[model samples]
Target: MWVRDDVCGLGPYQADLVETYWRWEQDPASLIGYGRQQPESLEARTEGIAHQLRGDNIRFTVYHLTDGTPEPVGVTTLLPDPSVRTAEYVVMLAPEARGMGLGTAATRLTLDYAFHITNLRMVWLKVLAPNKPAVRAYERAGFRTAGTLRQAGYWLGQVCDELLMDTLSSDFSPPSVISPLMP
Candidate 1:
């Protein structure tokens, strides 16, 4: 069954769809990576992400384009801290799936799930400092800068900071977009 959120549609993953999703991730030239080399095998990447999904530490969901196909256009993972009342989120969308407002919609929907469906007080995430588009999207969706971790990520060659951002449960609503902003 497909689950509808205000921003995007999601569904439980099926093993058969792994290959298609795998190829999307394998393409390092995609928006998520900078034309870097990818894992040698799609199977390897699929298994790794699947393992994460099954593990106790994370909750995983797959997203499709607004058209509602079974083919996934994105993936989201929510990793709870040891306390389980707080968690961090990571979302990645295919290059073609972005910039059409899907990211913002999907994120707002995720925030609702994080805050209402779960017992979370805070939902946080870290984005690479250079990813300005993502930063802007997070801000528009109600996430505020919590802090930054300097030299936290060493990608390509030089070190980079990760901008830590957060949204509180009290700051979110089911009608997420139209809700009044909290002070």
Candidate 2:
């Protein structure tokens, strides 16, 4: 696991955690932040989880540590475009886990893993503009605005812009750690 000062860690994804992810994906509150137009049924959600588990993406279950016990609080994924050595970063914080900065911490940890372990060139993400908290979190994690898709999303019944942000492998201080998971 990638530990972060007892606040959160990125643990290997496990099948048993599918239900937790499904719950977060279906939570209305989470949907708003995720900018998901609709919630998935159990069948669809499970199928999607299967895809992740099958190695179609690099995923991790985010866990919050309570006195050393890790409780899952979110998930992060990097949907890779291997040909270009780039990927789209996606993260979802459980409804009860928002506003605590776990998402930002997780993003930073994942960025380190992406560039150091996974050997990716760049990582990018699209977030609803109305989701200020998420935007701020991504920025805090070393991402910079790449561009914006004006009114490209619908949030809370209003059309919202989608902000594009990205970070290159060279954007951060030189990496000091490396792992076996290379692309």
Candidate 3:
């Protein structure tokens, strides 16, 4: 399966999976880790959804596993704009994979792509305040709490604050450090 920095050569089956991803993100609450859901069409299935997917100055790329199943486990991407050399980022792991540490691994891989490939100065993501697990993961991943946007989101009938966490290209340490220490 495709499991690298590029999404430029997805075959038909992989492309179909990417389309299904857009459909699944329709629920606002369901998109806690992904930000807001956007409208999509069968005709709009391009290799990269960055130009179409919107949330401030962010964008995303569909990521696949190395297995032959070709199933997509999550989406990841870079956010590049004139005001910041950093790329805004986001990721949403499948529910069943939540505690498996896959999200953190996927995040670190993406960061490596952003910095080494995209040559970004920094990479950042916004997480809802209540998502303690994610916040902790970001912390463990070498991202510091850069700032917070109070009541930045209105999800689940309540105003939710957002934590803007970031890691500089120079600050990101490899997840391999933890892998050796884990059982």
Candidate 4:
């Protein structure tokens, strides 16, 4: 496991967790900014997971309660843009985990990993403007709007604006009370 704290925990991804990720993608709320309203089949998703294993992507499973045994709640990933030393951040939660602060907590954990462990300079994400709650969560995790692409996202047959937000290594607010390692 990466970091197991009170709010949430993250563990390195394994093949056994493929089904859990496939299920999370099936949630409509999870597809809001992902372009497709419907999720890909398990096989297709598994191929992507396999790629994550082989590529520079850093993927993890978010756990709900981590004291006794951490229960899986969601998936968060950092897809690196190697040339730029930046990454695209993405997170999805189970339906039951929505509305709670899990997404935000998970995001902070992932950011901590991105800035502290991965040595990345920046972590960014694109969100459909309609997903106010998600945008808020990203902001709470220290992301700031870099720009907006007008009508750049399509959802349920309607085109919506997209917000490009990012948090740099300097923006660090460690997931836990103690700060991550630095020189």
lDDT string, candidate 3, 86-171, tens digits: 77776665554466565666677667656665678988888988887788877766788989999887555577889999899889
Give me the runs in candidate 3 sitting further than 4 Å from their true place. Answer: 1-14, 27-29, 33-70, 82-84, 175-183
TM-score of 3: 0.68
lDDT of 1 by residue, 43-68 (tens): 58667767865686543445654465
lDDT against the true structure, per candidate, is 0.68, 0.85, 0.60, 0.84
lDDT agreement of model 4 with the native: 0.84
Per-residue CA lDDT of model 2 for 36-59, tens digit only, reads 777788888778777778787999
Runs of candidate 1 with Cα error greater than 4 angstroms are 5-7, 29-40, 57-65, 68-71, 82-84, 154-157, 173-183
Looking at model 2, which ten-residue stretch has the lowest summed lDDT?
Answer: 174-183
| lDDT (Cα, 0-100) at 179 in candidate 2 | 41
Q: Which parts of model 4 are misplaced by more than 4 Å?
A: 174-183
Clashing pairs in 1: none
Q: Can you rank all candidates by TM-score, best first?
A: 2, 4, 1, 3
lDDT at position 107, candidate 4 = 91
Clashing pairs in 4: none
Write candidate 4's Cα lDDT for 15-84 as tens digits: 8888987887887867765776666889898888777788777888898884577788888989998899
Candidates sorted by lDDT, descending order?
2, 4, 1, 3
The TM-score values for the models, in the order shown, are 0.78, 0.90, 0.68, 0.89
